[model samples]
Target: MLRADGIHRVAVEDPGSLGARQHLRHCGLDTPPVPVDTDGVRVDELRATGAPAVLLTPAHQFPTGVVLGGERRRELMRWARAGGLIIEDDYDAEHRYDRPPVPALRSMLPEHVCYAGSVSKLLAPALRVGWMLAPPAYRDALVAAKRFTDLGNAALPQLVLAHLMESGELERHLRQVRRRHRRRRDAMIRAIRAHLPGAVAHGAAAGLHLTVTFDGDFADAGLARAALAQGVKTQPLSWHSQRPGRPGLVLGYAASTPTDIAEGIALIGEALRRLGP
Candidate 1:
């Protein structure tokens, strides 16, 4: 919505999270769908949108798990140099198994990128703690908007987080979770291979979840509901699409135990069978 007020069009990745588009539409903004490739959002298509800015999850793409490749990173830097704004959501930038951590795009193009990150996955979503760093040009305005929205995030949790940061407890917790999460991730991958052999998995290199796609006749949402009926919950790939993409599921492993993950995958396997694959 903020983009609609100042910009003519917003470039959102096609087959991206539609929740983002719905929020923009609620804000009375028009979104133009842009294509994404293995490297991330396609730069040429983004430029074609003629929009001044774009939103991206370059560190770890939402459903595809594809990191923005090196050349694409340079391309994005060039795009930002041409006065393009980049809204960088550093979601789950910390968790990884097979790859080293990717640097935040904001670190390279801080002047052009708005970086938003939260503790939703780190500690828990109940914390409601997230930070945003924007260019100075937008800082004052964003602060004003935030002030009007809630005067500021609650004082106590902020202080507690401050203590955690200062005491290094946060880092300690992150290390602990990273170790545990890696095991769960492996378990989930194993489960996928055992139960859903036809599916393709993505983003297993990091983060708490794995995005899996399969060629099937059933709608992703229907499959999701079927899984839910069997006491398993998952997000359909369609929930993220601004435009049609594929049939798949986003299976989260971090919050669940290894046993639960195996059971859930088994349930999903059963659901798929009940639904005729």
Candidate 2:
């Protein structure tokens, strides 16, 4: 849709989703890195990029997990209203634990914001179904693009998802998972404190995973490899960053049991110890 709309330059959140950056590049878009701070993507830096459009994960930012702040949201709205487009990927808004519901940029200015979300994070990625809301000017082009792409998503899954949504079964499922995921998240936090004392966890208020950054120059890839050799999986923080940043890991607790979460962290701690200072 963006290509059809003549938007070529997009400011992406740095240390954001590596997959997203790859996707933008593959789609032939010029992506400039926009730094993300604790409050979320730095709007001042975003403006500095001079890109007409920006793609970001505002609700629960990927890798780091900071929600875009209120003032930044207002500033973003103003920017969008003044001809900039906002591509809001509300990927894990439903997975929130410690906070009240947050609003999407699309909600504030549908005319300027293009909202995209999927059941992948909410339910299952196997469903291979998601949705997009575009401004009136782009809606038809969006539909045409979909038709040209895969002839639209399969019918059965959409019908089933629609049924689950209309019958409120999906919400019930989300409620159940949220409670379950919270327990696992707590377990992970406890394990991190106990096993990896030098680590500081981030984005724990929402999402399936949290990031833990170490103080000094760190060897996160070595840590991840060591854990992997011991049957534990981990992602290095640098994999997602366009620039040099702290050494850290992105660990997921969504599918693991509390016991498993503890054991994994313990293994990670053991690995860190072996690669001594």
Candidate 3:
């Protein structure tokens, strides 16, 4: 869509959606990192960049997990109104365990937001099924792009998913997974408190992953490497950052049992301690 719209420079959240960054770069678009705070992507910073388009994970921001505050949402809409484009990646908007559900930014302003989502998190990435809602201006072009890109996804799986959706089987599966994911999230929080005091956890209120930031100086990459050596895998927060920032780790709890979650966090704590005071 960006290429079709002739938008070559795009603004993305710093420490934001890595997948979006990868996609944009692959398409040869220049992506400038705009800072994201408690309220979400800093529109002021985005405006300063003078980029015509931006990719956002507003509902549950990637890595950070902070929802875009209401006022910021309004600000973003205003930006879109001023001819700026919004690429809303509605990733993992389904698995909320705490607080009220946040509405998708695309819901508020469909004309300016290109919303994309997949069943990758819900069902399985192997299915390779997803959908996008593009504005009228980009719809035809996007369809052409999809057609040229491997003639679109397999129709058999898409038809099967449609059947699951129509029969309400998908919702039933979601309810079951939500319960399990919430338990794993809680276990990770408890383990963080028990084994890694002083480490602050973010995005715990929702989403499948939690990001924990720590004070003082420590190489988060080194910590991740140490944890991997002990058979626990983690993504260093720096991997997502375009600029220098605090040391942290982004850990996903959805696929593991509570016992495994606890053990993984404990291993991370051990790795952190070994990294020194």
- Across residues 139-197, which tens digit of lDDT does each residue of candidate 1 receive? 87898889888998888888888999999999999999999999999999999999997
Q: Compared with the true structure, what per-residue lDDT tens digits does model 2 show for residues 112-205?
A: 9989999998888999999899889898888888899998889999999999999999989999999999999999999999999989999999
Q: On residues 1-277, what C-alpha lDDT tens digit does candidate 3 reach at each position? A: 6766689999999888667788789999999999999989999999999999999998888989999999999999999999999998888889888888889888899899999999999999899998889888898888888888888778888898999999999999999999999999999999999999999999987889999999988789998999999999889998888889999999999899999999999988888888884
Alpha-carbon local distance difference test for all models: 0.86, 0.92, 0.90
Q: After superposition, how far is residue 241 of candidate 1 from its true place, in Å?
A: 0.9
Residue 105's lDDT within candidate 1 is 93
What does candidate 1 score on TM? 0.95
Better of 1 and 2 by TM-score: 2
Error of 1 at 224 (Å): 0.6
Q: How many backbone clashes are present in model 3?
A: 0
| Candidate 1 lDDT score at position 89 | 82
In angstroms, the error of model 2 at 275 is 1.6
